[model samples]
Target: MSPRSILFFLTLFVLGITASAQYTEKINSNRPGTSQGAFSVGNNVLQLEGGMGFGKEKHKIFDTKTNVFNFDYTVRYGLLIEQLEIRLNGRFRADGVKQTVGANEEKINRSNFEINTLGAKYLIYDPYKKPKKDTTNYEALKSWKEHYKFRWKTLIPAVSAYVGANFVTSDNPFTFPDDPAFSPIFAVIAQNNWSTDYGGDWAFVTNIIVDKVTTDNPAIGWILTATHTVNDKWAGFIEYQGQKSDFYSDDILRLGGAYLFDQDLQFDANIAFNFKDTPSIFTFSFGASYRFDWHTKDEIIEKPGLEGGVKEGEEQENEEQEGEEGIDGEFDEIEGVENDSLKLEKTPFINTFEDDSFREELEQDLDERRTEERLERERIEQEKIDKKEGKKFKKEEARRLKREAKEAREAEKAAIKAEKEKQKMIEDIDAELDKMEKEQGVDGELDDIDKQLQELERMENELNQEEKEEQKAEEKKAEEKKEIQEEDVDAEYEKYQLQQERAKKEEAKRRKKEEKRRLKEEKKRKKEEEKRKSQEKKEDNENLDIDKELEIIDN
Candidate 1:
């Protein structure tokens, strides 16, 4: 093959291999202590996490004390499922090597970076099932209580499991007398975790990783770890890490505790024992890490069915079920009781008072009160009746007085009318008299005129001027008297008009007083009707109270 083609194929092969092993995700599980599973996407979650520690090794190389450090990281995800289970697995490791100390024994500075592991994990089971309580009785007792079991609470179990491939890249330079050029290591790991409760607060986890190294190395080994969560956020772990590489084998036992401040941040401390050496050596470690909780979308909300008060409801249901069973068993016994000489314990048709004497006393008191009330009511009714009779008498007297006054007014009106008629007749007679007198005066004047005419004729016959002048003066005097009489008649008519006006005003005053009396009578009648209705209503209420008293007595 051409070199170019070979290089292209090699690149493709490398790319494929890298693509298969490289984990791309938003969550990093290795940043701090984590539960079993990786954070994933969609219906599943994927998480990548890693951490490394560096410190001086306990070993000395020919009195040239050396320092050692380790680095490790892993990534994984979990598939969502309904059953209380999940898959879990991840890879990680610890590495120890030594670097020469400085010329001064008190101070040593060394730095080594190693990729301990790349792994994945899943959750296996929820360590604890959520607590549940039921509260069916709450509803049945609501009216009797002001406060009730308004909410129910419970906890649910959660679990997960996982498996993954692990690889470690070593950055070791062969500067010493005996050192390796490179250590290519590979591993396969399986892990499981179970959260006892819904919050993943408590958990039991176990993991094992088997390692293989391309180059024979003394450091590579199989690792086993078990962890228990003491609280929602705190965990203690014991781990066994041993190596059975082609060159040598070494084992280390570690006891550690981790506190999760959040999904992304943690603090850890550990005490480790190196068992492979002639005498076991102990080392102490303490570390703090800041992790971005990438699994923020993964929330553990308490299920309603597993809430705190849910057990009460469950208990109530159980009670009801037991009661039903008891009822069925007691049915025959209850039937047999019907034939017993003693009274059958059946539901009472009427509830008897527990303290019959007390009830009797109460009944007697009620009866006495009722009788007193009835007598009082009767007394009031009698008083009302007496008042009504008195009022009626007063009304009759008033009516009689009004009638008398009315009759007097009518009599007065009749008298006034008669007087007016008499006056009118007198006026007519006077008018007739005046007319007759006027006629007579007219006739007399005519006669006088006739005489004057005769005289005029005589004067005319004798040609007498003085006699004609006397006649003209006499006729002027007579016309003046007639005008005076007509003025007198007009004065009498004005006087008659004043008298008629006075009579009409008197009649109006009398009629107004009568109308006022009539209105008063109507108001009194309405008041009497309303009083009657009120008395009837009072009687009805008394009757009802009496009936209730009787019913109580009978009971």
Candidate 2:
């Protein structure tokens, strides 16, 4: 690849290391230093940052001494998005130059805008935009090392791109004689932020810039900065800036600190120096940053579910309603059948062939027979439905029990594994302490090691306590599940008992009807035997009268 292509790709790589733009509750300012931050001020926020400084420069080649007074300012306004901002940056410089030309000294004065640029920066990549998942339930089970492990994702920084134009008028003292009226400037910015073990936050920002691209003496430079946030209101930073060009080449270092006065304001101070003896430079500066925030709260929109365009909550409610309606309908159908049978049993079945009192007795008997038959059919059908439902309930209960058992086993195994790991770590630490003692004897390092061992022991004790709490929670859950199972069994047993009582009542009614029918049959049999004996006696008397009539006729 050509040098230009390679440079373009390299710029992109460096830009990938920058910080993402995000709206913070407190004003975020790049101050006390000249390096640019990757993030914008925030959408709809206008910020002003400026500084004033004095410096002295001496050039060995020309035997010239110069006194410089400079003021630099940046007016930044977040545009249509949080990730984009437009800024106006300018530096005004006044210089008094004294030169010795062969012992004939001369003094000259020059003043102009050393740098003025209008640019817009847009964030291209943001690694921190995604939220981290919550793992509170399992956090206590994790080892100390695992809990504090470094995340590789943090290595990927947020990146931003900057494009601007430098407007230099004719005969500017700060620019090369061959510089054009308008020159393009392009930059790639990157930043990485992470927390230290000591609870402090660190931010590293990088900027790769190509300035005055249209001019004969184009400059390429880079700025690297490291900032540490000591507390809520105090922060400190160190920066290194390097520039290379046909016109000038120099390296500068700066140290600075900032104090947050309020949510919208900050104060900062910094000192800068260069190592080059040709024109060794030193400067001190103080600055303040303030913002006018006009951002509003973002609106929240909920998307519909994939199936049937229903919302999740509404879909769940509809499912529950349908299930309830199904169960209710089943019960209603059974109750209706039962109510009809009951009314049939209660009403008298009239027997027109019998007397009024006998008809009433007969109706009662018939009604009992019909009621028994209807109830038997109903019981059979009900038992079938109950059996199916019971099977389903049993299957679900078994699956639930199996799942709970599996989870319990896994938890037990995890606890055992954690215990073993803790023991091994303790052993290793002890061995290290013993080896150190043999090698160096007891000293401050040994005491520090001992303190670490104590801290480890304390951590182990906390882990054990957490394990006990987890065990208690599991036991409580199991007890509640058992109670629910017992309640279900009690309900089933009560239903069975009710069914048995109904069967017994029906059987007793059937036996009473059989006894009444037997007595009616016995009374009818006795009446028939008496009638047969009376007819036999009347036939014997008629035969004797016929014999007497025949003897009188013969005489």
Stretches off by above 4 angstroms in model 1 are 1-54, 60-64, 69-111, 116-171, 174-204, 213-220, 278-283, 288-555
Tens digit of lDDT per residue, candidate 2, span 1-555? 234434544553443343322123378788887777887877789999998998889998888999989999999998877778999999999999999988699999999999999999998886654322222223322344543455567677779999999998788988898888888999999877665334456777889999988788889998777777777888888777778888988878788899999989999999988777789898888989999988642211111110012223643553474477642343333332211011121221222344545644554455444444445445654766798899999999999999999999999997787667656655755665565456443244445555665675576567657757865775565566566756688755655565576568557755754674565456445545544544554455445444544543443
- Superposition error at 265 for model 1 (Å): 2.8
Candidate lDDT values, in order: 0.43, 0.68
Which clashing pairs does model 2 show? 17-191, 18-158, 18-190, 18-191, 19-191
Worst 10 residues of 1 by lDDT: 338-347
TM-score, candidate 2, is 0.50
Candidate 1: Cα lDDT at 223: 44
Tens digits of per-residue lDDT, candidate 1, 451-541, equal 6546645644453354346445534544554567567876556545644765675578457656755665565566566556656755665
Looking at model 1, residue 514 earns an lDDT score of 66
TM-score of each: 0.32, 0.50
